[model samples]
Target: MRRPFEQLPRSLSPLPGEDLHGFVLRLAHRLDLTPIVLLRHTGLIDPHRHSAPARRMFMLEKDELAAFCTTTGMSPQDAQALTFKPHVDSYPPVATALLGLRGLSPAPRGVFPVWLLTTSTRYCPSCLAGDGSAIQQRHGGPWKVVWRLAATFACPEHRSFLHTTCPACGLPAQRIRGRSRSLMVEPHTDPLHPSRCRNVTDPEQGPCGARLDSAHLTDNDNPSDDLLNLQHRLLRARPYGTSSALDSLAGHNRMTDLFVLAALIRATWPLTADLAPSPSLARALDHDIGRPGPAPSLRISATAQKRWDSDVFSARGTAALLAISARILNLPLPELRLELRRVIAAMPPLDDAAWGQTWLNLRRDSSPLFRHEVLQLLDQRFPRPLPTHVALPGFLLIRRRSYSPKAIPQFLPEEWAEIITAPLGHTSGRSPGKTAIRRGLAAHLIQAVTGMSLDDAGTYLGIPPAWMAAWGRFRPLEERLHGCRADLSVLFQRLTDHVADQRAVDYAARRKRFANWTLPESDLQRIVENYPGRRRLLARGSQRGARMRVGFSALVWSQLTGSEWRLAPDLQPLPVEGVAMVDAGVIHQLQGRNPDHQPFYTYLHDLLPDYASTVLEGEDHQ
Candidate 1:
């Protein structure tokens, strides 16, 4: 590690160009190496600033090469490998060459086709140290001088070209640590967190079950410096075990933006705050920021902060920020993992506009959709856009979002408590929205299907019966639904046992209330009673239909040809969703009207895919 990098001769055999500058540039094209790596071994194409137009042309050419590789299914690493051949035999010479331009031979031969990797450093024009000098000067010496090379750029002769010192190590002209790689690589967030392992007891450390990374620091005014190193990173702050989203929202704007990504990992994710926890962060806040932890936790007269829970420092931002926080917070595995998961979940589901830009940026290769579970999620979120729907139900069936409120606790530090208040409610509670009315209607609809008293379904879905009844009358759609009776035993058991098809039975049960199926309390008692083969009723077509069904559903529509069908519980019909639950006595009535129509299938055909209703629990044991 102490050896000069100049001795590291670049092998250009399989690559396309030759000559020092040309070879380094070609090696850059071939190896996709960073300029600092290149400069350590060689030097700049122009020792001085070339015309801006000339530099633009060079950049344009580089951009074109990248585009070509991306369009052809080549990753940055693949491109490097396709053109690189790391030299095992000529290693010493390359190492010497990497020690900087001073150690090279003028009559260099054989080195033309040498194996080489490249990296680059930028220098501050003022004092030749680096643009970081002014920032480093403020932090003083301890963090300023990191690399010996960064110091050399400001050595007397070149001092005038440098600006300020380094922020981390404070040395003039020193390069900050850039990633070291061979051939080519994609600079992704490291994916080696220990939490991903199968250890049963969660680790006491960070989410990855190990120490977290350091957060990168940026000058509030110079956003350009932050973006300068991104080199093809995805914009979406995706978490580990997942790909990223390169959206414009993540673009550098000097905003010091804070985000909280909460994943309901394992059992529950505690509610964490979204501000930096350090006293330094508090010291950094503007006067208007109040308590300086999070905007929501401010102790101003706002009632929300008193009962608030949530940790300070949102879990996202530049790799630098994430790295820094990971290092500083020393978060335990559970907390870190939850934070990572939240980041994953909080990431807006990628849309065509956002994902497309990334695909295009990547040269339109496969469009990053190969991940199976993701492809399915794509279908669920945009059934029409992804061009596939059958796979979606399975995807959504795997992760239902409802968990207890336990996650709220996990978010805040143990010392903090949650402050909850009715967001806009006042003491008088006057002027309510139509939301209440719609909710009432939804309640009334449920009672029709489960044959629950207004009180029963209220208990399940968590609304009171009186409010539910009033809401029902308020919303017209929930007022007119009914279903034929279902034996209560069969409901808690298998729908197929009492009804013809399980899908139809479940569908009927779910919809009875919405359809306004009259369920006298007697229906519940009937199924609760001894098995009655046929407790006769007045009969169909009587003033009060005898064999009345009960259930509420929005699953009926007439096609141009007049065909109709029942919808699966997901509200869409998959072959797995094909079950028939018909009025045991009335199957004969609709026979000729629809051929493939099992009374169950009849309602199902019209079913819409309600992706939120299910999760794949790995095949029903039932």
Candidate 2:
């Protein structure tokens, strides 16, 4: 635990559950906890508060404490093995009071002391490790903590400082992190060690907008500042650098620079004037069929390729070239392309159109850290939309890398508006405010355009993804069977050794595969597969033949849900719910006493005279 939080730059950024630790530390300092403690308490450490050393590290809510001990199967008596004293002498009145100071408020004013533990210098010796926190607000269960760093009282540290690596051409944040790291370095890189790459120029709190000079490089031809270089370096280190071999990711070493590598890549572009992928990038990949990664042979989804082209090479442009050489060391071009594929795969799975539009946003020169010329060029080619999806991952990615959240607006084409209604990822609890807004609006638009019910509109607007996980948890494996029989059959044959023998693979493969199957047979085959047995699977027959069709699979749920339930934006059926109600429309699609039925609100009007105020029109009407 590094003390005087300012000394360590790495301790500043937050880890998943560590935000609480940092908050307490910063708060303690801010509240002048040291003064009262210096006079009254020996140290903040309480010998009686926790039974174990680890338990003492974090602050838990009252209920949480009970749960923790219960979950861990330690009786309160055994748990009493730790200390419980507040050590109020070392903490300020506010700090002490917040932590159950006896004389102040009747109840402890603060939430769990998770912030201080998370920010402890002991864990990381870089920067203060705290999530973005708002000033003390009224206490409620739903408070959100922001994760960006902020400057207090004319931060001198805000100014950019020269470091060994260039932000543009450096290894991913996961690899060689020290402290004071960029907000948007590649994920799975390093937990940022802030000052390690402190800004050379800054007003504090945002992008420094520095211009490139030859001095940024150590040796002009070096590729030591990049991720690929680091990986290769670790490769040379054997068991020491191996995954299980090393205790921590940072224990490994590397010196590649990605920026210069990109420069080399661009210079060799248009390989042989073909306008195809460059040879230098191609040779880097190791896609020899069953290899760890695909070879120089490009097989990443077109959509993924488009996103990649927009993110790294195309969007970042010449500026990105600065970091490429440092990242990729001994690899050839094909391997590098394969590396790009890996990066794309690692990134969250968002739609291609959204990714493209976000890329189009990169062309703007809204900030000096990026190339305005490129943004201009992109604008000329892929004009902005009327209104864009505000909660895009691209925005988050850019903000972190550019070191300025505001830079996102500049990169955004005129079309994209800030999503104020809901946040991007409610599940993670990170994204908040205005994310669901767009989907909600789309539902309305579909209603107007297709004359579909609000429920149907929302369903149409939010269909299950074809192959990957989508927003809703519902799985649509069945529909996929018919639509992609050839692909599925090929995959099954390759895996099952033709054990689930497919006599025919056709559009009606689902029907054909299950043609001769009697009722109550091949349940596993029915699931985990579709058209491979299409002759049998898709063979729709009477109730007796199909054995009383029961629970409609997610494919049917996806279609029916959108067609029926997404009638309005106000209600959204989250991923997991145990019940399904069936009504007349559903009966027409599948002949069964299906459960997903709910009375249309229209009847309530007649049942209750004052229904005008309580019962909505379309809702009550059958």
Writing each residue's lDDT as its tens digit, candidate 2 over 4-93 gives: 211211212222222332322323333344212211121222323211122333234354345434333434443332222232212122
Question: TM-score for all predictions?
Answer: 0.19, 0.19
The sequence of per-residue lDDT tens digits that candidate 1 reaches over residues 1-622 is: 2222232333333222111222233344334554334433332222242211111111113442354243333344433333212211112222222211111111222221111212112222222112354422221111111111111112222222222322333321111122221211111112222111111122343222221112122443132222322211211222122224332212211011111111111012122223333323223321222334322112121232311112122111222232233222234645644444443354343432212122111111111212222234334544443211111100010011122211111011111110101211212221233335334322333433333444554554444344455444323221211121111111211211212221222322233322332234353234324223334343434432322222212221111101112321222332342333443223223322445555443332322232112211211222
CA RMSD (A), model 1: 24.7
Residue-level error in angstroms, candidate 2, position 266: 11
In candidate 1, which residue ranges exceed 4 Å CA deviation? Answer: 1-220, 223-283, 286-398, 401-467, 470-622
How much lDDT does each candidate structure score?
0.25, 0.25
Instruction: Show how many residue pairs clash in every candidate, following the order shown.
Output: 154, 172
Off by over 4 Å in 2: 1-160, 163-622
- Give the root-mean-square deviation of each candidate in angstroms: 24.7, 23.9
Candidate 2, residue 144: how far the Cα is off, in Å: 21
